[model samples]
Target chain A: MRDPGNSGHPDQSGHGQRGSIEALQEHVDALEHQSKTTKRAHQEAMRRERQLRTHNAVLAQLSMNALREGCDEHVARREIVTAAADALNVSRVGIWLFGDDGQTLRAVELFDRQGGFARCQTVIRADRYPRYFEALRENRTLPAHDVHRDSRTKELLHDYLEPCGITSMLDAPVRIGGKLVGVICHEHIGPQREWTLDEQTFAGSMGDFVSLSLQMGKRNEMEAAIKRQREYLRQIIDISPNLVFVLDEETRFVLANKALCDLVSVPHQELIGNSAMNLIKDQEQARRLRKMDEAILRQSQLSIDCEESFTDRDGKQRWFHLIKRPITSVDGSGKQVLGVASDVTERKLYQEHLASMVRELDHRVKNNLFAVMIMAEHTAMGSNDIDEYLHAFNGRMRSMAIGHEILAKTNWQGAMLVEVINSLIRPYVGENLRHVTLDGPDVMLPARVAPAMCMMIHELITNAMQHGALSLEEGRVDVLWKVEDQTLHMNWIEHGTQDVAQFPQRGFGMELIERTAAHQLRGDAQLSFEPPGLRCELNIPLKLPADRHE
Target chain B: MRMAINAQLKDKLKDLRVLVVEDEFLAAKSLETSLRKMGCEVVGPASTVDEALAFIKSRTIDAAILDINLSPGTSEPVARALRYRNCPFVFITGYSNISVLPDDLRGCLILTKPTDPVSLAAAVGQLAEHART
Candidate 1:
């Protein structure tokens, strides 16, 4: 519209036309500018919308990952760095966490569009870049359009910004439990670029996702530890020899070990939630158990130890020493009882047997004392001198002691017939012990008759030794015995002496033999001095009639 | 005059028959000797319940000394038979406890083993005198 001919028109019409044309040109320029600005604004809005869409998708993915089971902090960090780089269209992105000392930032996961993923152990010290660190602490999001000029980022220009070819940076502080943890940094490697508000907000969200991931990782670790601990405890309980169980306040089984389950003949899983009372069939036992359980629940008793008897599947009664203690329930419902029972059946039986043995011993000791008194009085009666009396009394007492020693071998139950004869005859025929031969079928004397029989045998031996065949050099005694018709029939014969009828009856030994056999043993004895050196025949009842002392 | 007084005491006991039931032969002989010394005619030194019981049934017994423990059985039956006949008896036992005697016989005089001969004679004399009354 502006030409050489148009410049000559200085008239009012020409001036008016020039003014209108200028105005129209100005209006066209304005319209074109308006259209161009609108196009730029539309492009900017679309870019932001795309960035937001990426952020939303990435955040949704990160949130899902954070919620996933066993998603650790490292995996979560990788996801954040990769997602941030992609959303912001930046080449390099990394997540750095503050060390425990709060003086250093260490890169946990670093991602680059060109390199895909890189292992970075890069650390930035707070003392080295105090300005940058302070900015991070003070600001939720630090946006530096010019890395060398921004007061918040200038400290990084010499080493970080220049070396990495990073002209711009957008970083968001990571916080966990209301404390600053670290930062998620998006670095632009090309010419200086501005960080948009939408991008800054997206960075903040990534930092939040990191916090959640850290928490999730910690929770996963705790859960795994708890599971392992529970399994370990289960194993320990199962292997225990004692019956073990945990019962709730209602007396229902909350936990039952293999020992308890095996005892009840029930499956472990099946025992839980069942009443402990149901396991015991006896009404009286179950009632007592319930009373104890109630007392424990009421806190009146801290623990109880009691003996209980249970009839097993074989119909044999088994005793158990049971211990129950109150414990705080893990489920937090109420107090519970932890019970352990040890089988004590054998121990109880042993204790009863020991008591019976002691009673038998008491009876024997008293009876033996009476026998001693009788022997002392009798010995004194027969002796003309104190020395003679002492010798006889000592011999009698020794004979009694030998018999007791033999009986003690069998716990005083009985003495074998052969053993009794050998023990009594051995002392008198010391060098000739083997010469005094005993021939008899094996027999056991009742404890009641043993000591008296010993005394009778002692008297016979004394008479033979003092005056009969035993006094001669080549003298020997032959004893033979047999069991017949429930009677111990024994015969004693002396050899190597011709003067059988000259047997001395000066001492009371001969009379004592006859008297003991008749009175104490309830038996009979016959002595004849005619034939083979004063042969004596004895007969005693093997099993005394109606002498059950018990 | 002393001889006459002794004879008079002897006459009081001369016809009194005492029974001795002891399980131990020596102890039984001692009892019989003690009773005989006191001028009492001795019936038996029975070492068993059956022997003593048989003597109580057949022999004339005015007083008795019974050893409580016999080998096969106790002298309780003999004491019972003697008491039934109104013949007074004293129990000689190795057991120190009188509780070993039956409830009916626990009231009787009890002499533990190792008792003196004088006490045995005195017990028999007292039992004989009591029985006559």
Candidate 2:
């Protein structure tokens, strides 16, 4: 309309042109507003992209720190859980392990938002969280945008996460050697949040670190256990009382305890490389021991009650009861002989000493019985009265008892000659005729010789008292003996007898004296009557039976 | 008849020479008398190792009778000499156990005392016959 007529051209044209220009201006303003909006949206997108990259870089740095501190499995798991919780902005983080039976997942570690860990208070049984256990057992990641939405996971989520104010959850399983060991879970509250692929990948990597650290920790525990067991066995073997030794197949000593060193009277360092037979006292015995060792090697085990005399460091003989057995190695590939020995020297000596004592006791009892027999026979021959026989028997037994007492003092070997003479002659000595004299060389006779000599001396003393010099107030007697060329010559001279007379017949006393001095001792005797008293002389062989001599 | 008996004794004594090894004087004298009565000639009554060794070197003995134990120990030297000469011998011992006998003398003729005259004569005759064979 404004451009329709030319008459109103100036006014209409200006007004129309103003209107058109204003319209153009408004269009231009709308186009500029649209371009500015597009530019600002692009700038905001670039800023958000840079922020996400920084978060990813921080997560990578945290994961590297967790791996670097993996010396301790517990500390590494805690660091990983805490780092994951902070990255995801969650309230709590936990690591749960699937039980070996595959029915349960138990919490291994737990971390709160404040970076503090609760150990015993935060364990979750898998029965209460079936979905979580299934995901871990299947070795699959579980992403729950709204934990309360899934009926299968609602109660479990509530039981495991509600107390800790968790509403959304992200979980990844940790695997080692192709087996599902545990899971790493991050819990968030209030609303569901989108989980990015990068965040899920980062969580999985942290799970791998936890797996390797746990495996290493278990291996270290096993090694420590083995070390403790070895030390215990070594202590037991070192403190054993008996002489325990181990020898190689070549008969060389390989191991010996302190007791073995003390037994051989050598240091442990000196005994190790030496042959076992070197401890034997005799060379011939050593040869036999070598044969025994050979036999033991051929046959896997051998037990022998060997009488071996071992020479100590000072060359003293010690006896042992050695027990050796072959020890097969655990794998049955190697063989060693284990030898144990016990000292038996004292027991052997005691047995020998006891045997000697028994033989001596038997000899003494027989001699005493023989003396009683002689006394009974002589008394019966001298007088017919029973009273006289009893008195004489009593006196003879008393004298025999005295001899036995002296023998006991000398261990039944022999009695001293002077002691016997003094005891036998003491009863007959008087103030005026106290001239009982004894002269002889010192002689140690056997048990057999001492008793025979005692009886002989007793008879001579009795005869001197009843019928010879001791019958008078001024009587005297001299007893003397000397050993020459293995012959004992004894003389008994008596003085102050009433008269010297030749015996018409052999009386019981004379027969007793002659038989005892000759037959019992294997000697000779000669008795003669002199002017003042009676003289008796006897010769006896001094050598005894060979067995009884030593 | 007496002369005939004497002739028989002479015949028994003709080649019977013996060596007696004993340490005890009484026992040796008794053995000598018994050997003479049996019509055997006794060559020696050697008491020790040296005397027995000398007698063996000097004389020819048909048979030997030895006491197992001499002064020191078992009469091993005399036994060894008798074996060397291949002479027949018998061991007279006071002990019944034979473990102490020399290894070579084991299972040989061993007579225990106190020996009777008849057994002694028989043993000597048997040993002599074995030697002759």
Q: Report per-candidate DockQ.
A: 0.34, 0.11
Which portions of model 1 miss their true places by more than 4 Å?
A1-50, A227-245, A255-273, A302-325, A339-358, A373-394, A408-423, A432-435, A438-453, A466-468, A480-491, A496-530, A534-550, B1-133
Clash pairs, candidate 2, are none
- Give all candidate RMSDs, comma-separated: 8.0, 11.4
Write down the lDDT of every candidate, Cα atoms only.
Answer: 0.81, 0.70
Task: Give per-residue CA lDDT, model 2, range A1-550, as digits (tens).
Answer: 5643334456677887787778778888888887888788888678657656755775576556655532566776777787777766777788888677765667888887775786644555667676656666674566777777855457675456676666777788778887877778877777777666666665666677678667767766676777887577656776887678877777888778888888777898899988877776588987887777667777644665566668777777778888877776435776767777778888888897887667545544543453355455456657658887786566566667777778789977777777877776676563333567778998666565666576677777777776787777788888889989777888999877756563224555565567555544557789987667788998877774453352
lDDT by residue (tens digit), candidate 2, B68-95: 7664455678988988999888888655
Over the stretch A12-34, how does candidate 1's per-residue lDDT look in tens digits?
Answer: 66677877789889989999999
What does the lDDT come to for candidate 2?
Answer: 0.70
Q: Return the lDDT, model 2, position B88.
A: 86
TM-score of each: 0.68, 0.51
Instruction: In model 2, state the lDDT of residue A69.
Output: 37
Candidate 2, residue A475: CA error in Å? Answer: 7.9
